[model samples]
Target: MAPNRWLRPEVYPLFAATGVAVGICGLSLFRHITINPEVRVNKENRAAGILENFAEGEKYKEHFLRKFVRNKSPEIMPSVNGFFTDPSRN
Candidate 1:
């Protein structure tokens, strides 16, 4: 409960003084309370963000498919000769 909210002008200074004291003590104990002022997203870079996500997805897809193919039949998977002809895995 805020004392000033319920108390009058003469009583307000007392409350304010006490508040500053308590705040200083609390801040001393937990001094790491700082703002995380991160930059907001830019609307103009949306297309670039989309492209980055798409490219990342493409990378994962290729890696996954390649690994699957290599695992199914390493000898015929294409890591040696074909290196890119495993039909059933991808």
Candidate 2:
């Protein structure tokens, strides 16, 4: 009965603080690994079988945004681009 009373108001802040601290640490670690090319190039950071192949290892951590944008057609606005380039538009 008495033990249950300790679980009320004061513990919420402690839980919130712990969650925030964990989020901050996770974000910091991610940023550290991402922006630091030295970390990216480290052999240990790469996938297991790819350790000997630097170029293949790079594919493992290549940013999702870069992968999405790669080899895409250069049209900034497809309809407008077509309007300018199409001989029929003239």
Candidate 3:
């Protein structure tokens, strides 16, 4: 389309207004969808449940970890010495 022949000057502001209105509506929908407190609590509860079950399980906390500490003295992997540690050391 040629700029002076195909494009109408009056339609430019209409297009800009429509674009802005769509952007504002999208942002409003996104805010309502993301900042829901109930959904946040639900997500947090799921994460907390997983961590609690895995790290604080009675079998792991009381038995497996203790045996692992006794068997692997420093409990440090040669490749990841700084990254991993047995809770017994602390």
In candidate 3, stretches whose alpha carbon ends up further than 4 angstroms from where it belongs are 1-6, 38-90
- Between prediction 1 and prediction 2, which has the larger TM-score? 2
| Model 2, span 9-89: residue lDDT tens | 888899899999999999979876776444555666654432356664586558686799898887789888898889988
Q: Rank the candidates by TM-score, best first.
A: 2, 3, 1
Q: Model 1 TM-score?
A: 0.28
lDDT of 1 at 64: 49
lDDT tens digits by residue: candidate 1, 1-90? 686567777887898999999998987555333311121255564435434355545554465457767657546434645645556546
**Deviation of model 2 at 9, angstroms:** 1.8
Which candidate has the top score in lDDT? 2
Give lDDT: candidate 2, residue 18.
92
Which pairs, if any, clash in model 2? none
Question: How do the residues 19-86 of candidate 3 rate in per-residue lDDT, one tens digit apiece?
Answer: 99999999867755565333334555657543424443454336545775785647446536644554
Scored by CA lDDT, what does every candidate get? Answer: 0.56, 0.74, 0.59
Compare candidates 2 and 3 on lDDT and give the better one.
2
Off by over 4 Å in 1: 1-6, 32-90
Clashes of each: 1, 0, 0
